[model samples]
Target: MTLSVRRARTNDVPSIHQLLDYYAARGQLLPRSPDELTEHISSFTVINEADNLTGCAALEVFTEDLGEVRSLAVRDAATGGGYGRALVEEIEHNARTIGLRRLMALTYVPDFFARLGYGVVAMNTLPEKVFGVCVTCPKFRCCDEIAVLKHLD
Candidate 1:
């Protein structure tokens, strides 16, 4: 199957929410409602082979130069097929297009990001994420996700 990544559209919300819920239920990613996905659809990128949605990710800009890679997930059957990497590459492209100089992700799979040039970083180093966003996360006090960052050219 040929996979291609592109900007998300309004009609993709249900599929995106389902894909996110699949990982969220396994505690591999955060859960996002269909409404939330729809509201931020412009920030998302999706990978599909023909009409089947395989993976998705979003670039959440926090500042003029900083953005976070959020809600990255791939279909269980599609994992290891490079769709995840494609989705993130799309996100990085989107971030750079918007003039972001840095991209960060809070992930359980730091190695995946590392393969894409991300480096491990302390959560506290990102106050915009720590105070502005983490404070609202249910796992804030017991967060186990590692923070990873990459500098964009």
Candidate 2:
């Protein structure tokens, strides 16, 4: 099964949300609103098979040297087919092209990112993501997600 990614558009928002929600509901990811998705549409890329959006990921720039890979989700039926890794690679490539020195992610599946060359890091190491997103997370006081970083330099 060959899958390809493309920049997300306005019409892709619903499908993207649905994909993310699948994982979010299971506590694997944070939930995002359609409005938020729409607002950050340009930050997203979707993997499509035929006419369906099966996976989605976003790169959120926090500083000149740091960016966070967030909101990554693949349809349940599509997991383990490498859609997650592909989506992450797409974001990682974009990060390098845009000159970011490091990419960070807070994820439940640290092993998955590790296989892609990310190393676990202390959450304190990413103050930008901690203060920007984690502070607002309902699980802020007890975030179980592992922090991982991949240096592009």
Candidate 3:
């Protein structure tokens, strides 16, 4: 079967949460509540290969000109299978469709994003994210995730 990214469905919540939780448990990502996931499910996308969930991501709009690539995770077994790249491409397409000029991500895998045309950026440059969301994170003062940005065309 062909693998493609699709809008997330409510039924995908459990699997999405499990995939995200796997990363969160290792501090690679922040934990997301099921309620939050359900509430913003419309912002998410998923990749299912032959009925097995391979990966997921969400495009979180931060402002009229900016959007974020959040909750990006690929199943352990699918790490090298291009699922992550596919999800990011879908998020980029969605962001451009919505008229967003920039897409940013705070990622542990900067190289992965860089390969997708994203450039490393200083966290302070994104005040909207730094003040709006990152401030409340437990790792606020010590956040280690690399910030990357891609200007959408």
Candidate 4:
């Protein structure tokens, strides 16, 4: 089961949306529309195995020193095989390449992120995230997502 991560192309948007929708329905992540995925396609990377998309993640810059890892999802059939970790690493590599000093994620799987060197943090510490994305989230006031951050510097 060899998998490779590469920058997402327009053709991958449908698969990306499907993957996110799966996790989103389970409340593990947020749902993204195909249009939204296409708009930010360049910020995303997808894991592929023999022409099949197995997983996807995105690095979205919010500030000079901050970025968010969004829409991370692995296919149901591909879970527990290191695809998620690989996608996260690929996003981190992109964050470092773009000179971002920190990367954050609002996730239900905090322990998974913690194992990857991210520390749990207070949501208030990320005002940009709170005011920008959180405010628009349906779960805003009752948000159950945990904030985790990894410093690249």
What is candidate 1's lDDT per residue for 105-151, written digit by digit as tens?
99999999999999999999999999998999999999999999999
lDDT per residue, candidate 4, 30-106, as tens digits? 88899888999999999999899999999999999999999888899988989889999999999999899999999
Residue 70 in model 3: shift from native, Å?
A: 0.2
Highest lDDT against the true fold, candidate? 3
Tens digits of per-residue lDDT, candidate 3, 1-153, equal 888689999989999999999999999999999999999999999999888789999999999999999999999987998888899999999999999999999999999999999999999999999999998999999899999999998
Say which prediction, candidate 2 or candidate 4, comes out ahead on TM-score: 4
- Comparing 1 with 3 on lDDT, the higher-scoring candidate is 3
Model 1 residue 119 lDDT score: 99
- Global local distance difference test of model 1: 0.92
Model 4 lDDT, residue 46, Cα: 95
**Deviation from native of the Cα of residue 109 in model 1, angstroms:** 0.2
lDDT of 2 at 92: 91
**C-alpha root-mean-square deviation, each candidate:** 0.9, 1.1, 0.8, 1.0
